[model samples]
Target: MSGHVIAIDGGGTSCRAALADAEGRVLGRGKRGSANIFTTSDTIGENIAAAAREAVCDAGLEGLPLKSIPAFLGLAGINVGERQRELAKALPFADTKFVHDGVIALQGALGDEDGVIAILGTGSVYLSRAGGVSRSIGGWGFAIGDQASGAVIGRALLQQALLAHDGVREHTPLSRAVMKRFEGNPEAMVEFAQQTARPADYGAFAPLMFEHDEKGDVLARDILLDAVRDITMALDAIVFEGCERLCLLGGLAGEYRKRLSPRHSAILQEPRGDALSGAVQLALRAFPPQAVGENG
Candidate 1:
C-alpha cells in the first residue's frame, strides 16, 4: 500500500472513505457522519480525516502519513458558488481533488464511458459526460432544487396535507395519512415543516409516498408523477446530448426506473460500480504507480 490513495463519497448522511493502492484496488472502507459542504462544511474536514484514518487502520496501514497521501473527494453542492474553494482550502490532504459528488457517481457507474447519472436520494442531482466533457444540472440543495429527490417528495407530501387541511385541495387518502402522522394537528405539521425539518427529516416521508402510490392513492400518485417528470426531463437533456448509457442511483432509483417514460427504458442499464469506486479510479489516474514510485 505504498502509493495508497483515499476515495471519499462525501454525502448528506455519511462520509464514506475507501483506501486503495496505486492500481485502484480497494483495501479498506470507513464511514462517518454527513460531509455536505452546503450544510455541514464546518465538520467535513474533520469527518473526512476521521474516515480516512479509519480506512487506513482498517487496511492495517496505520503507520502511513495521511497528510502526504493523495485523496479524491466527491461531494455534493461543490459546484455551487464558492463552496468548492472553501472546501479545497480546508481539506486535510494537500494532494486532493474535490469535485461534485455526481462526478464520482458518473465515474463509478460508467468508468469514463459516455453516460448520464441521476442520483435521487434525500437530495437529487444529475450529471453527464461525453467526449471528456462533464456537465451537471440541478444540485441547488433542498430549499430551491433537488427535484425528484426523496426530501422534495417528503416535503411535497406534507404540503399536500396542509393544503387539504386549509381546503386549498381535496383531501385524499395519502394526504390524510400524512396528517395522521402529526396527530391530525395542522399546527404541528406546520412547526415541523417550517422549523425543525432537515432535508433528511423531510426525506423520511418518501417511502410513505411509494407505499401510498402502490395503493393507488390520488395524492401520492400525483406527487410521484410530478417528481418523475423532473427526472425524465433531466434524462432527456443528457440523452439528447448523445449520452446513450444511463444509470439511476440512490433510494428512489428503482421506483423511478420503473416509472420513467418508456423512451428511456432501452438505454437504462446497471452500474459497474458506485461513487467510491469512481473516486478510486480518479485517485489512481491522478497518481499512477510510476508517478508514486514502487517503493513509496
Candidate 2:
C-alpha cells in the first residue's frame, strides 16, 4: 500500500479519489466538496490534500509514510498548461500528472483508445482523442458557454421567466413554475440572484425541465432537445477522424442517451469504465510493478 497510486476526479461539484494497486484493484475511495479551480482556489490545496489523505487512509495505508506514492489528478478546467503545473506543484503526491477533468473521465470510460466523451454535469465539456492527439470543445465556464450544462439550463429557464414577467413573452407554465420557485417579481428576482449562490446552485432545476419535456411542454422539449444537440455537437467537433467510438459521461448524458440524435446514437459505443474506474486505470498506469514484480 505504501507504493500505491492515486487517481482523482476533481470536478466543479465534488472531488472523488480512488486508491489502487499496480494491477488496478481499487483499495479505497474518498469524496469531498467541490474543488473546481475556477471557483474554489481559496481552499483548493487543502481540499486536495485532505481528499488524498482520506483516500489513502480508506485504503488502509494511514500508518505508511507520506511521499510514498505516485498519484494522478484529473482536474476540471485544467486545459491551461500553467494551471496544471501549479496544481502538480501544490498537491502532495510524489509524482503527479494533471489532465483535464474530461480527459480523465474519457480515460476512465474508454481506457487509452480513441473516442469522444461528453460530460454533462453542473457544467459541461467534450473531449476526444485519436492517434495520440487530443482536442476539446465548449466548457468555457458557466457564464459564457457550457452549453447543455445544468447551470445553462437553469439560467435559460430563469431568463425565460424574466421575459415573461417583463411582458416580453406570454406567460406560460414554465414561467409560472420558475417564478414560483423564486417566489418573486422581476426586481425581487434580481435581488435574490445577487444574494444567492452561483449558476451552479440553480442547476438542480434542470430535472424539472426534463420532467416538463416528458409532459409535452414545448419550451421544455426545445430546451432538452437543444441540450442533446449541443452535447452532440461538442462531441462531434473533436471525434477522431477515423474513430467511431463515442461515450457519453455524466448523470444527464447517460440518462438521456435515448434522447440523443439518431446520428449520434449510431456512433456511440458502450463505455468500459467510469471515472472512478478510470482513476484506477490511471493509478495502475502510473505505478506499474517491476518487470518481475508480483502484481506486474
Candidate 3:
C-alpha cells in the first residue's frame, strides 16, 4: 500500500517529526528527546521510531505500519558515513535517507539561495552554500568543538564558579548562584560534574548565564562575551568565504543575535522555513511520489 512521507529533524536536545502526503501537504507533527548520533546513537532507532509513530498517530493514521513509510532523517552527529549507515539500518522505514542536520537547516533557512547559517544550541556548527558548493565548519561535537554552544557556555560557568570558590576569581551573581545550587560545597560540584557530564547537563546552565548577563553580572558578561567572540569569528569566516546572506538558527541564536555587532547582524536574514520543513523537502526530493510507485 502507498504511504505518507516522514521527515525528521533530530538534534542533541530533541527530535521532531512531521507527516506529509504525496502532494507535500503536512498532516501532523510530533517530538521526542535527544537523537544526537554521537551521544545517543545506541537509542537513535527507538527515538526516531517513537517520534515517527506519534506523528503518524497525530496524522489520524494510528496503527499504521511504519515499514510502509519513506522517511528522510536530518540528524545531528551523523556526518560520518559509518554512523549514517548504522543508523539507517536501524530505522524501521522501508526506505530512509540520512543526512546531517546542517543540510536541512541550510535548506530551510535559505531554500536555493546562497547563504550562511550558524546553528548554536546544545551544540554549534556553521554551514555555508554558494555556487552549488556547500561547506561546514566546526560541529566537532561538545568535546573539542561547538565552541559557542550552550554546553560550552554552561561548562564555563561551572568552571568560573569553582574558581570563585577557590578565591582565584572574583565571585559574581552568576558564579554565586552556581555555588548555591551545589549548596556551597566544592566537592558537591565536582561530584555532579563527574557523574553527569553530558552536554545537556552543562547546557542546562546556559539560561542562568543569560539571565545573569541581562542583570549586569560581570562574570556572566565575561563568559558570554567570550562566546560571542567565538561566534563572531565563525560569522566572519562565512562572510570572507563569499556568503552575503546569513541566518542564525537554534536555541541560542536569538540570544547571540542581540550581542552581535551591527556589522555582523546587518546580514542576518529570516529563515524560509524550519528544519522539519527542510527535511520534508529532502524527503520529496529523495522519495518523490513516482519513485514510491504512487498512482496519480
Candidate 4:
C-alpha cells in the first residue's frame, strides 16, 4: 500500500488536489480545470491525474511515483451515471475511492456531527446526516436539476437578456450589460448557450449577477429571488427537526446565505473546514501513512 495519500475535491468548475503525508499534513496543492463526470468524463481521469501531478510537483515530490498512491476522489455528477467507475479505472492511482461531491462537502462542513449541507456552486446539491445515516435531497446537475446553482442563475440572466432584447420584458441595466457582452446580438447568446457553453461557461456570469445585485439592479434581484426559492425548498426537505448544524458551501454559498430566510438561521454557521480538508482527513483514516520516508 502507498504510504502517502492524495485527496481530490473536483466539480464542474475546477478540480483541486492535495498531497499529504501519512500524518495528514498537506505538503503541496494543485488546481486544474473541470472534472464533472457528466459533461467532462472524457477528461476526468486526465484532470485528476494532472491535478495530482501538479500537487506532487508543487511539493517537489516528483521523485515519488503516483501509481503507488492511494486516492480519494470526491467529484461532481458521480451520482448520475456509471462514468465515474470507468473514469477511475483510467486514473493513475493504485487504489481509489469515488464519492459524490456532496459527500465531501458534508464531511467538510459538519465533520462527524450530524448536520446538513447545501452546496451552491456551479452546480448544487443538498445532503443531511443524522443518526449514523446520510441522505441526499437533490443535485441532478444543469441538464435537468441544479435549480439554485450559479450555472442556472447565469443562464437565467442571459435568457432574460434575450427577453428584454425581444421587447418581451423591460430591459434593466443588468440585461443591457448582458446583451453588451454578446455584442447586442441575441444570436451570439444562443450559439454560446446552445453550441459551446458548459456549466462553468454559464457559471462565469454568476459573479456579474451578484455584483449587479449589490447595486439593486431589478433584473439581478428577480433572478436571485427565484434561485433562493429553490434553495429554500431544498433546505426545507433536508433539514431535520433535530438538525443542529446547517452549512452553506461552494462558491455561491455566502451569497445564498444573505438571501435565505432567517428560519434556519440559528443552525446556520460556517464550516470548520473545506472539502479538501475533509478529503485529507478521510484519506489518512482509510489509508494510514506508514513511517514517513520516500512515500514507503
| Lowest-sum lDDT 10-residue window in model 1 | 287-296
Task: For model 4, give the 10-residue run with minimal summed lDDT.
Answer: 287-296
lDDT value for model 1: 0.86
TM-score, cand. 3 vs. native: 0.95
Model with the higher TM-score, candidate 2 or 4: 4
Over 4 Å off, model 3: 1-3, 240-242, 291-295
Alpha-carbon TM-score of each model against the true structure? 0.93, 0.89, 0.95, 0.95
Question: Which digits, one per residue and each the tens of the lDDT, describe model 3 over residues 162-274?
Answer: 99999999999889999999999999999988887789889999999999999999999999999999988877787645557888999999999899878878888889999
Higher-lDDT candidate of 1 and 4: 4
Per-residue lDDT of 113-199 in model 2, one digit per residue for the tens? 887888888888887887867788877778788888888888787777798888897776777887887775677777766687575
In the predicted model 1, the residue pairs found to clash are: none
lDDT of 1 by residue, 212-259 (tens): 899999999999989988888877776745557888898789888889
Clashing pairs in 2: 108-278
lDDT of each: 0.86, 0.77, 0.89, 0.89
Off by over 4 Å in 4: 289-296
Q: What is the C-alpha RMSD of each candidate to the true structure, in Å?
A: 1.9, 2.4, 1.7, 2.0
Better of 1 and 3 by TM-score: 3
